[model samples]
Structure formats: C-alpha cells, structure tokens
Target: MVLQGLTVLNQKNYEISQSIGKNLFDNINEGGFDYVISECQTCKWQIDMSSNVTCIHPLTLLCMSMDA
Candidate 1:
C-alpha cells in the first residue's frame, strides 16, 4: 500500500506535495481531513481575513508518523 502511494507521489510535479505526500496522506486517513494545506510565504506580512474557507490541522501523530 505504501509503495503504491509512493508511486503516485513520485508522479506529482508540485514541490510541496511531492516532498510531503506521505505525511499528507497519513493525515487524511487517520484524521479524516477533507483538505490539505500548502502554505508558502510570499511576503513576511500576512493577513487572512476571509471566512469562507475552513482550516483543519491534522493531529501530531499523522504528521509525525509520516516518517515511519
């Protein structure tokens, strides 16, 4: 299962997703997440005022266990 998932990850072109695919997958599976976050700062000053989108942070286990 891991190998198949890894293969899919390898085919991806996104730098962030490819680098952290395993962790993202695990988070979704274990925590039942519906979306993944890919945050890159374009500028130091940032302000998020929109309320239409929802953010769900995966549990620590999902992020940490990705290495295993």
Candidate 2:
C-alpha cells in the first residue's frame, strides 16, 4: 500500500489511510492523538501536534506502534 498522509487529530478534519486504518481509527476513537511523525527515508520519529501535517512515504504506515 502507498501511504501519503495521515491526520492524527480531528474527526471532522483528519484522515487516515487503509494501511493504518485500524490503528489510526482506534487511536482517534480512543482519544490517542499523540503520535510519531517522520520522513520515509530517515525513519526518524518526531513528536508532533495533532494539528500538524504528516507526509507518508511509499509503503508507509506499515505499522504504527503506540506507547501510551
């Protein structure tokens, strides 16, 4: 699956990909807005605000592991 972007915040405004569908939806539904956003190449994670824009790389969001 090709992942392009992810919105980890709002329901009315946010969006999630089918690749990360369950985890993303679960997080939003369960109020788990906190997430790690990163570029595809580096795989370097960063803590970001839910309002921020996240760009996903090809085959991105293969898995989203949550700590909280």
Candidate 3:
C-alpha cells in the first residue's frame, strides 16, 4: 500500500526530491500549511512558497521557518 503524508528532510534530500518531481505532487491547499519551505543550496538561503505564489520572500526567511 502507498502511504501518503508530507515528509520534509534536509537540503540534500530536498534537492533529490525536486529532481524527481516530488514537490510537484504535493497538495498544498489541502492542509494546515501557510507555505512550504526549502533552502537554496547555491545561496545558502531558505525560501517559502504558497499555493498562490512563489518564493519571493519579501519577509524574513528565518522568521517564516519559526512560524512553521
């Protein structure tokens, strides 16, 4: 059987998921999530994106994660 749940990992594992289109399959609007976060490997920065938007990050990245 296929178990369905959100699984978040470190930067390395996150990238692997991105490559395999794992992030594409997530249903962001179906849960208690304001946004999902992932860190940029190249810039050493984190980003938060909602279903209605991309990771523009007008607010602080550290603060966003704290709320999550």
Candidate 4:
C-alpha cells in the first residue's frame, strides 16, 4: 500500500497528533516492511523523526531500482 501523502500530524491538536503519530509508527514498524515510500516531504520528515525506519521518496526508490 502506498501512503503518498499521509498527514499523521494535526498541528491544531498536539496531544492527539502525538498519539496518532505513535500509533502509526508502531503499526508501520510491526508490519516489518523493508521500505516506507512517500512523496510528501512532511510525511517523510514525520516518519523519520518518529521512527527508526527511514522513509524514501518514490522517485528516489525508482531510480535506485533502475540502477540495481
């Protein structure tokens, strides 16, 4: 599943945003996927900031795959 522009954070509600972000991060980690691909810069930043897994941009991954 591609979550291209998943906005997990809610700037209006800090506590709720943190809770949602944590849940999302935990679920993603538990899924054991090798890569998290996203097109949105903010999404990438959020994922990276919250979890050990690094999110890669779709175009970057595509270029990498082509090279491989």
Please provide TM-scores, in order, for all candidate models, with all chains considered together: 0.23, 0.22, 0.27, 0.70
Error of 4 at 20 (Å): 1.8
Can you write out model 3's per-residue Cα lDDT over 14-35, one digit (the tens) per residue?
6554444434435544445554
TM-score of 4: 0.70
lDDT of 4 by residue, 6-61 (tens): 33445555455556577788977888888788888877887788677889999999
Clash totals for all models, in order?
0, 0, 0, 0
**In model 3, which range of ten residues has the least summed lDDT?**
41-50
The predicted structure with the larger lDDT, 1 or 3, is: 3
> For candidate 3, what is the TM-score?
0.27
Q: Which number leads on lDDT?
A: 4
What ranking emerges by TM-score with the best candidate at the front?
4, 3, 1, 2
Candidate 1 wrongly placed segments (more than 4 Å): 1-19, 34-68
Per-model C-alpha lDDT, please? 0.35, 0.38, 0.39, 0.72
- In model 2, residue pairs whose N, Cα or C atoms come closer than 3 Å (at least 3 residues apart or on different chains), thus clashing, are none
Question: Residue 6's C-alpha lDDT in candidate 1?
Answer: 29
| Pairs clashing within candidate 3 | none
Off by over 4 Å in 2: 5-16, 32-68
- Model 4 gets an lDDT of 0.72
